[model samples]
Target: MKKSILFASALLASSMLFADSLKLEGTIAQIYDNNKTLLIDSIYGGQMAIKVLPNTEIEMDDCGIFGTDKDGTFKDLKVGNFLE
Candidate 1:
């Protein structure tokens, strides 16, 4: 049916938008609070800018604390910290 075809097409298109993701893991090079952006030193060997939205979840990996690590905020993120 036309509805089925349209739904499939829409699903395929949306999937394509998320299909080409490259993982970048590196240290946080800088934070620009005014611009709401963070600069990361990419593992692939360079720095790139990633925008920080108010709702963006940033969490740190801590092994020994034994409880919720603490909700992240921009102020708690340090420039030397590693991230993915």
Candidate 2:
């Protein structure tokens, strides 16, 4: 029983480490034709895009080159902007 409990705990901890959180930020490299998706250049130096849900809020910071704007959209978020 003790061994089983230890194993379970270890597995849980390892799983948590590998879990992916969905806080994405990046430049809008390309907007899909449907407009529901866009290609983003992630701050981590990878290109990826995710579908946006209805009524979702996109926020950004207020400083830096691509800082967040008053409308929650980042400033100068063109094809070569950095996002976090």
Highest TM-score: give the candidate number. 1
**C-alpha RMSD by candidate, in order:** 5.7, 6.0
Give per-residue CA lDDT, model 1, range 14-84, as digits (tens): 98898768687999989898988889999899889989888988786776758556668888888899887
What stretches of model 1 exceed 4 Å from their correct place?
A: 1-16, 65-68
TM-score of each: 0.68, 0.45
- Return the top candidate by lDDT: 1
Scored by CA lDDT, what does every candidate get? 0.85, 0.67
Candidate 2: list runs displaced more than 4 Å: 1-21, 59-84
